[model samples]
Target: MSDEQDIQARAARGWRLWLVFLLLVLIGLAISGKMLTLNMQEQAFLKRQGDARILRTAVIPAHRGVISDRNGQPLSVSAPVSTVWMNPQEFDLQNASIDRLASLLGSDRAALLSKVSRFRAKQFLYLKRQMTPAQAVQIEALDIPGVYVDREYKRFYPAAEVATHLVGFTNVDGKGQEGVELAFDDWLQGVPGKKLVMRDLLGRTVKHIRELEPMSQGQDLQLSIDLRLQYLAYRELKAAVQAHKADSAAMVVLDAHTGEVLAMVNQPSYNPNDRSNLGAGMESLRNRAVTDTFEPGSTMKPLTVAAALMSGKYQLDSVIDTSPGYIRVKGKTIRDHRNYGELDIGRIITKSSNVGVTKLALSMHEDAVRNTMQNVGLGQVPGTGFPGEQAGVLPYHAKNRLVERATMSYGYGLAVTPLQLAQAYIPFATGGLTRPVSLLKLERPEPATRVMPEAIANQVLRMMETVTQQGGTGRRAAIEGYQVAGKTGTAHKVGSSGYEDDKYVAVFAGVAPVENPEIIAVVMVDNPKGQEYYGGEVAAPVFSRVVGGALRMLNVAPDNWKPATQVVMQ
Candidate 1:
């Protein structure tokens, strides 16, 4: 009986051990199945979590357009530059590596720390902009947390001060500020693009995923400016301003047929490349040729003569006695330089006689005189679309007393820009057609307005030609190998106390190769202090050099080559 009971106990113990082993195996298989199911279901969620930390949308910068001269010489351009930035929230300012980064970037440790601290809650900040590539490399080598580098463009002016006022400049944000840059900002500015990029812990881009948008670069602008002529005009105008010790000066050169601005320059100019002077004042930044207006002085005499011809009241041979040399109207005296004696209407313009012009103005209806001035573009913008262009002052002729009308005849009581003065003489060169002045390149000459009858325009042009002849006001304006026609002006500079006794504004306007004119130039020298202040003496020489060089440059045929070459005794 004892043996049988022992066997039974042993069998039961064996069975219990086997049962426990089977239960363990079944639990292991159930856990394995659950693990497989969870792995398959959570794969996408895990991927999203990992990507949130490394994936980023990055900006792909676009480049600004280039500005070139008519000959395709570059005036303004953008060059690639590197900028150093940081993620303020991720940056560890207290790290030992922070000092190394500041030294490599040439930044102050305290300043960098303060800047980071100020924007600690923010994710992005610019530490340095427009850094050199070598400096950027040194910064990357430091490998500070959250430090980054980006490629950007900086505006560069190749022409510098040569085209400063016209080409203008851009700001830190690459927005146009002044000049052509400001005028065509919409066309010159670029559109930036975006892309998905994979970045590392240090904010460096490791891989590019896909481009979200394509970048569009700004279109290039080809202006009508001739760089060669621009340099020439700038040099001459600068020299004249210095030699004469004048306050300032301006010059404008136009294509006689197209009315395109070939060259425009001013004195006291500043470099567009260096903006330090901008803090001083904007006086040097002004394009005086277009922005500032001045009394045209005797340059208006040609317009007066043209109007007189248009009215049919005065023939080219019509004679008037200017023997007294002076006349009085409205308690004011209008005088001539000398007794011009009894002279033909043509001689009146050749001499630039104020008394003669006064007589003509008084004879015509006031409205006619006013209409002529207005028709010629006085008191109207030159339509160049330049910033700060002044339309000048033109009072109603009907309201003007006799004296005021007389002053308007000789280019007083009104104001005009150097550009307008240049534009006004276009009819003389274009046979009564007045073309709008253009700074942009035109494919073809546009149709012009008929400001005066063609016959009357030609007759007035003939009379103006004599002004460059012997015994005329603008003899110095005569160019070699060309038939020059122009008027001279020397007006007392108006001061706070009315016209000053010693100061004068010398001005000269004319068309060259008069037989078939091809160039029209206007020059104004303000407050010339030399012994000679007359327009012929002070301003005519500049007109001669510029217009003469321009004609030769264009290879225009000579109209009076023989006489022009001959030396005339002054």
Candidate 2:
């Protein structure tokens, strides 16, 4: 009985063990099948999830375009720089690395701590921007966790304050802020590129995967300014402003034939590279030659005489009686510097007689006076495309009041920018052709529109030539070997309470080598302090020095050059 029970028990145990072994094999096969499915079908899904943590799309900075003068001199440029950034979420502010970073960046430790704490949840934050590459290397050497450096570009003005008003400046983000930089921002800006990259836990790029898009560099710009002339004009104008203690000053020089702005400068200019004082005010930032306007004063006498000549009512030899030295029109008395008695049209211009020009305006229709000025570009924008350029105030009173007409004849009751005045004089220089003013270099001279007859323009130019001779108001504007043709102007500034007797703007506009004219320039000194505020005394000298140097620099043969006297050796 015991043997049968033992055999039965052993059989049951053996069967149980065989069942356990089979169950184990089934479990192993199920596990192997699940592994195969995951390896084959879900591999891409897993890889993508893993890449989300370490793979990044990074920006590749693009280079900004260059701005150069007419002769290929660089006025503005872009230099490579680095921006120090950090992942605030991963940054350890409590670590000693923060102190080292603050020291290297020249940042306040408290501010750095406060900024990091404030933006602790942010994935990215800028620590410092526009650092030199050398400086960035020192920061990178620290190898602080979460800290990174990005390549970028910083705008640099090579001309500094010399051409700052014209060339302008860019912001920290490489956007244009003022001047030509703002006017042509779209043309000067570049497109940043992107690339796929793999990074480590420290957020440093380990390897580049592929370029998403190629970076497009900005296009270069060529301006019409001649750097040589610009330097000369700047020097002379700055000297005049200092000598006269003027509130401000501006000067513009143009290639008479091409209408290209050879030199344009203003006083109280600031360096674009140094922005410490950028927020001071707009006075230093303004391009006054194009933006500011003033009453043109006696400089308009030549144009009035030109208008009279255009009417065929007055010739160079035509006479006007200026006896008593002053005339009252509509109860407003217009007086000359003195009694020149009777003066011909040419002598009237040479003497800058207010009464003489007023008589011419009274005799003719007001439309004739207004139309001639309009044709010559007065009270117009000058079409330079410069930012904030003013069209100036050219009022045409339909009433045609005698006082208004008389004042307008002598450059009163009207306003003009220095640029407009300079462009207006271009007609006289180019034989009555008024070309569009250009700030950019042109492959060829632009087409011109005739504003006055050639004969009339030449005759007016000849009449103006007497202004720079001895006894003329602009005698100080005379050059040694050049026939200078110009007029002097001094006008009381109109204020809240009418014209201010103490405030005056002195201006001189002229052309050089009158026979075969090359360049035309305008100089304006506003609110000159102390005595000697006349345009002939303050502004005319600047015109002479700047234009004389420019004429010689261009190698233009002087029309008034006399042969040196030869002495025979005894």
Candidate 3:
């Protein structure tokens, strides 16, 4: 037990104590590091859950507007359809889910899978569209995950092709494609509603919330077309076209008082319910009444005669030397189908002589003839609401008088739509007052504008009546028991380069029941290829059929028994 031995033992004990303190410190550091790592992992896991889950935005499509006739008969309307939508991320592929969903939705699993795969990254996906209400109900009842039902609207034409030209149809996106639909698309399509919904990690819809104001539907429209008259017009036009074995035809019936289009039909029209049946051609969708322009031919004779008499330029009995069938003007030869020499004004109209009209045009200078034609509603665009309404092109009064005026008198150099001609004749039918035609259904007051004196218009009407009677050019248009006033047209069809010789557009325009005109119908036939290509042969019969059928439908009584006209002096 020496002092040195005691010091050695104490130092050894100090070394042991130092080692124990170091071990304790090392143990404490290990525990702190482990706790930090666990906290970091917990925070990361919560962050991941938040990122994976999201609130999806749901779209609510706007419903389209309705179109109805004056009597509230539905011309066009939208029906509720079910659309199946999917969030590809949510479609958990299960045997029962796939089978049940496919059977209910009438879709193949492969197609559904393909669509979902392509759209998975996208927030919204459409599975199927335009399903009927019953089908929609069946699909919604499936109640499968990721499968949801949305209400959509599909255009329905209850009248089918009856009002095809006026009502038109909408496109796949529910936007109007033509006719009134296209013209009023903005007003017909309203704002859509939108919603924000929260989803679970499995992509299940969990919460729905309103993120903005509620949406509204489009305003309904009322059209001016009378459904009954529309049916009659279509029926008659179809019958005439079928009987004639013609390519295409157009007809229009205007209310004599209001100028509202009571009926407008384009034959060989397509059914809006079946868009597949139609090709995207000018023929399929063209509104012929407003779009197609043709030489008015004999139908224009009344305009010239009326202008002649109205201007105090010529008397009804004034004789013009139209004998031997030709008038030489400015070097151009105006000839006719027959040699009508020394014809009076009445005989000139009755025979529809080209030479007679040329002389009449010459008698009244070029500017006078052009002005009269313009006053009759040619060379102007119809102010109807529909788009694509053509402003019929009238020939410019050429520096060459003979060629221009002669052609103008016979409707050779000018082009006009059937609708334009129909509107133009309104003044003659209603004592020389014209009103704008309407397509809207709401009641519009009949506003008449004085374009000519009532007396002159009456004289013109009487002349037109002669045109339809036994001796006139439009004799074929005479209704058996009715007093009809109309004119026939036989004009060459215009080609790309110029007027084609063989091609023709034949037309007839007139009013029925001479005592009191009720319906004004205009019929046009295109490219009738026959030996006799006159308007009397091609268009007069059509006018007779359409006018007759429409008159019967309107309950218009015939004026034959009443004997309104004078007997022939011969």
Each model's lDDT comes to: 0.87, 0.91, 0.79
Top candidate, metric TM-score: 2
TM-score of 3: 0.84
How displaced is residue 48 in candidate 3, in Å? Answer: 17
Candidate 3 residue runs with Cα over 4 Å from true position: 1-62, 99-107, 194-212, 280-282, 496-498, 530-532, 562-570
lDDT string for model 1 (246-364, tens) is 99999999998999998889988888877786666677889898988889899998888877877779887898898799988888988888898998888899888899988888898
Q: Compared with the true structure, what per-residue lDDT tens digits does model 2 show for residues 382-472?
A: 7777899999988996645788888888899999999999999999999989998899999999989999999989988988899999889
Clashing pairs in 2: none
Model 1 lDDT, residue 149, Cα: 93
TM-score of 2: 0.95
Tens-digit lDDT track of model 3 for 1-570: 899999999999999999999899988899888778767767687666664567666667777778888788988788888777776766776646676677666778887677677887776677778888798677666666677776778899998887877788898678989898889888888788887777655444578866655667887888877888788778877876676666788988887878888788887788889878687674767878888888888777777777777667798779988777876776667788878788887777788888888878777756766777788679998788787899888877754556777778878778889899998888878888887877775366556778788888887787788888877888888887899988888887778988788888888899887778877888898876556567787788878876787788778887886556888888
**Cα displacement (Å) at residue 79, model 1:** 1.1
Clashing pairs in 3: 222-441, 223-440, 223-441, 224-440, 224-441, 298-489, 323-340, 323-341, 323-342
* Clash tally, candidates in order: 0, 0, 9
Predicted candidate 1, C-alpha RMSD: 4.2
TM-score, predicted candidate 1 vs. hidden true structure: 0.91
For model 3, give the RMSD to the true fold: 7.3
- For model 2, the local distance difference test gives 0.91
